[model samples]
Target: MNWTDSLEIAIALDEAHPDISPLTVGFVDLREMVMALAEFEDEAEKSGEKILEAIQMNWIEERE
Candidate 1:
């Protein structure tokens, strides 16, 4: 998934880190976790604060 696929990334993150809260993860760690996903295939340099925020917001919604 690319940087634009925030919902998909959030879903993957939810599944991969069931015990972890997205609110607790900083952008740096979040980016690393996203890059580590088996399904993720995007350039690390493409991510920015807005994209990260979207992913985090989606992940929080997923948990709720």
Candidate 2:
């Protein structure tokens, strides 16, 4: 399943479990980790685009 589905299932499972906590299940931590990675990926892509654009603008021109 996708992220949303997995999230909903996690919630349901959490609601059902009295003995297990989020940390014990590793659900909360893992979700935060996945979200952080997604944000990092987005930032990295933006940085990469800026770097590429700068490189193109600063590239050497032909002497002809």
Best by lDDT: 1
lDDT of each: 0.97, 0.33
Show pairs that collide, candidate 2: none
Pick the TM-score winner.
1
Clashes of 1: 0
Tens digits of lDDT, candidate 2, 1-64: 2233333334433444435444333434444433343222222222333333332222211101
Across 1-64, the per-residue lDDT of candidate 1 in tens digits comes to: 9999999999999999999999999999999999999999999999999999999999999999
Residue 45 C-alpha lDDT in model 1? 96
